[model samples]
Target: MTGACRRARELVSDACARWHLPELVAPASVVLTELVGNVVRHAGTPMQVTLTLRRPYLQVAVTDGSRRDIRPVPAPDVRAEGGRGLLLVRELARRWGIAPLGDGKVVWALLPAA
Candidate 1:
């Protein structure tokens, strides 16, 4: 999980640098890290990460082999849900959500690039 997080951060840094949206690296890294961490902790299955640039927004997505409910913990006191990873994602990200993809699911966050 540690290695996966590191790699995901590196990829995020690369994407931000490539897109010339250096200001987004930090928040994007946090969002991506949280998304990946969710996959490692909850999904526990093979995952694929994607970083996409859409004008004023940067979308970080992680597709994992889990269809189970994965919701963002926007509120810090949501103990009945899970950890605060998604909480951080909610704070750093402009918007985030989870969606079913094939037999698995894809968790994503949109960070402002502008």
Candidate 2:
């Protein structure tokens, strides 16, 4: 999981640099990490991370081999140690959602890149 987050962050950082949207590197990395973390904790399946430049937004998504529904908790129990990752992602990203695919689902977040 750590390695996956590392590589995914590197990919997001590299993409931001290539696109000259350096300001997005940090938040984008965090959002990507949370998205990846969700898969590691719940899906436990091979995942695909994608970073897409959509003009003013950077679309970060993780496609996992689990078809289960993934939803963010508005306000997780304060005493709980886990389950706040998606909440963090929701707070950081401008917009985020999940899409069901044939064999799995794609969780994505759109962060302001401009």
Candidate 3:
């Protein structure tokens, strides 16, 4: 994993720990992993992951160098083990979206801080 991604996980876990929210730490890690992995896979080098916390909510934003269109597509079959990262993100995250950056975009996911 990239340093930015590893730091994101640590920051999120630390934030949850500070808030006395141990329950959310693991899921946050997993979701962060998937999103960050996507960035690493699709966007090449020079990526960043930012983490924000707001009492009951936590937002993770991953910035990468792909101005090209990228959208999360579900697997064609339910039993398919691959191409399910975004689906897992959708299921576990409270809300998620992509936002335009300087020349790329930021894929963000929000989760309950608790």
Candidate 4:
């Protein structure tokens, strides 16, 4: 989990730099970390992370080999450590959703681009 989260952060940071959108590095890192962490904890299967710049928004997608749907639940307790991944994504991303894939699903978040 630690390694995957670190790598996800690096990937988002690098992608922000490569795309010349340094302003998005922090939020992107947070969103990717939460998404990838969720995949690591729940999916327990091979997954892929994709970063794309789509004009007015930057899209972050994590595809995991699990057919189950992911719904962001409100944190039951504010002090709890768990169950806040999707909530963070929901708060940060302008728009986010999960799309069903043939064998699994792609959880995606879109952050507004300046």
Model 4, residue 10: distance off in Å is: 0.7
Model 4 residue 109 CA deviation in Å: 0.3
Report the lDDT tens digits of candidate 1 across residue range 16-77.
88999889888888888888887888789999999999977898999999889965355566
What are the per-residue Cα lDDT tens digits for candidate 4 across 71-96?
Answer: 65766687876787788899999999
Question: What's the TM-score of every candidate structure?
Answer: 0.89, 0.94, 0.82, 0.94
Worst 10 residues of 2 by lDDT: 69-78
Q: Name every residue pair that clashes in candidate 4.
A: none
The reply for model 2, stretches above 4 Å from the true place, is none
Candidate 2: pairs in clash:
none
| Each model's total of backbone clashes | 0, 0, 0, 0
Q: How accurate is candidate 2 locally (lDDT)?
A: 0.91
lDDT of each: 0.86, 0.91, 0.80, 0.91
lDDT of 3 by residue, 1-114 (tens): 577568768977887788787888888888888888787777775777777887678887788888966665656586766677788888889998888877999888899875
The C-alpha RMSD of each candidate to the native structure, in angstroms, is 2.5, 1.0, 2.3, 1.1
Q: What tens digits encode model 2's per-residue C-alpha lDDT throughout 46-85?
A: 9999999997899999999999897647789889888788
Badly placed stretches (over 4 Å) of model 3 are 2-8, 76-81
TM-score of 2: 0.94
